[model samples]
Target: MVTLTPLEAELLEVAGSVPDPELPVLTLRELGVLRAVHVRDADAVEVELTPTYTGCPAVEAMSQDIERALHAHGVRKVTVRTVLTPAWSTDDISAEGRRKLREFGIAPPRTRSASEPVSLTLGPTRTHPSEAPADAPIRCPHCGSADTELLSRFSSTACKALRRCLACREPFDHFKEL
Candidate 1:
């Protein structure tokens, strides 16, 4: 296992707990946005972050939150860096995050191999065909029923899809895996 200095460990704790602006219910660590935390000195620290998607509006907010969190934790100097290489994947999201998403009335992304093709549509007005796997079932978060249908390709957020449960007859969001 890797060892961390006292300050480094504390910095990690503080940075990891920064809540995502878009999904306030989950932390940056839970959302898998916090990539790394490196202590440059006793008074300075550097944090790396990866966005859920390119051009995600929450990136700047998340970076600001991280810096704020670190400063509040007594770090005199904090540098927040955005890393785009290797990209961000829903697979990086923690299991706890997935559970929390479900509890928040949002269906978590389905686990699929990297080879599986994802059909996603971008833009505010654009729409895509229902990409929900026909074979892989989707259980409703509100009613816990397998009977659900994709209402639209987009939800309130770009990372989610609109869905409705047939059993409960309620609309909810599904966190799409990218």
Candidate 2:
């Protein structure tokens, strides 16, 4: 594991505490995007962040939020760098984040290997969202039923898919595994 200096650790906590732009319910730390804080000088520091997905628009907002938070905490010349080399996986999301998402009427993504890239299929289009990507039955965040079916692959955001629970008859978003 990488060792951090005292100041870096403190800055990391501040930056990580910033709320996510899209999902206000979860912080950047819970989302698993805030990577590291490198103190270059006494007043200037650099922060590393990864987007939830490639070309994710939220990255810019997240960066600004982090910068604003650090600045309020007496940081100057803060630089939030976008890191994409290792990419991001849903598995990086903390358990608390998942619980929060579920509690907020969204289905949490199931655990998967971090190394596995999200797969895309080029099959014939179907009318129902439940036609493909048959990994497993998604549980409803409302009633906790395993009888939820996808309503649309695209929801409020690209990273989430819309689904409806058969048991509770409630519609919700599922954070698609990356």
Candidate 3:
């Protein structure tokens, strides 16, 4: 593991504190997108960022926000670089972030068991009377009921799916497990 200098560590904290443009409830740190901050010069720094997906529209906004944040923190030159080598997964989100999401009425993404990738299975056009995929049940964030059905594959954003609970009859967005 790389050991961060005191300055680099401080800058990381500053950059990570920027709230996500789309999801204002969570910071970039909590979302796990702020990858690393490298000190390039006394007044310059480089920040690595990983997006939720390859063509994520929020990435540019995130970069600009990071740049502005670092600049306001006294950095003259801030380079926000997009790194996709490792790619990003919902699993990167912190437990606290997940709880915040649930409280925000959005179902947090389900975590995978290991390094294995999580598979996506399309539900039927209508509600599937029973929760067949027992493993990854999309529970209602509002009512904590597992009897939820997908209303749309894409919700407010591509990363989330619209779902409704049979128990509470409430609609919510489920962060699709990456």
Model 3 TM-score on a 0 to 1 scale? 0.93
lDDT per residue, candidate 1, 123-178, as tens digits? Answer: 45422224544666677898888778888878989999898888899988989877
- Best model number under lDDT: 3
Tens-place lDDT per residue, model 3, 1-178, is: 9999999999999999999888999999999999999999899899999999999999999999999999999999999999997889898999989999999999999887676856667754445437456666888999899988888889989998899999999999989877
What's the best-to-worst order under lDDT? Answer: 3, 2, 1
Q: Local error of candidate 2 at 39, Å?
A: 0.7
What are the per-residue Cα lDDT tens digits for candidate 2 across 1-178? 9999999999999998999999999999999998899999989999999999889999989998998999999997999999996788888899999999999998998986657666677876443436644766678899988777777889999999898888889999999877
Per-residue lDDT, model 2, residue 95, is 96
Using all chains and alpha carbons, the TM-scores for the candidates as numbered come to: 0.86, 0.90, 0.93
Against the reference, the lDDT scores of all candidates come to 0.85, 0.88, 0.90
Please name the candidate that would achieve the greatest TM-score relative to the true structure.
3
Off by over 4 Å in 1: 1-3, 113-135
Q: What is the lDDT of residue 95 in candidate 1?
A: 92
Cα RMSD, model 2 = 2.4
RMSD of each: 3.6, 2.4, 1.9
Rank all candidate structures by their TM-score, best first, as comma-separated numbers. Answer: 3, 2, 1
Residue 106 lDDT in candidate 1:
95
Looking at model 3, which ten-residue stretch has the lowest summed lDDT?
Answer: 123-132
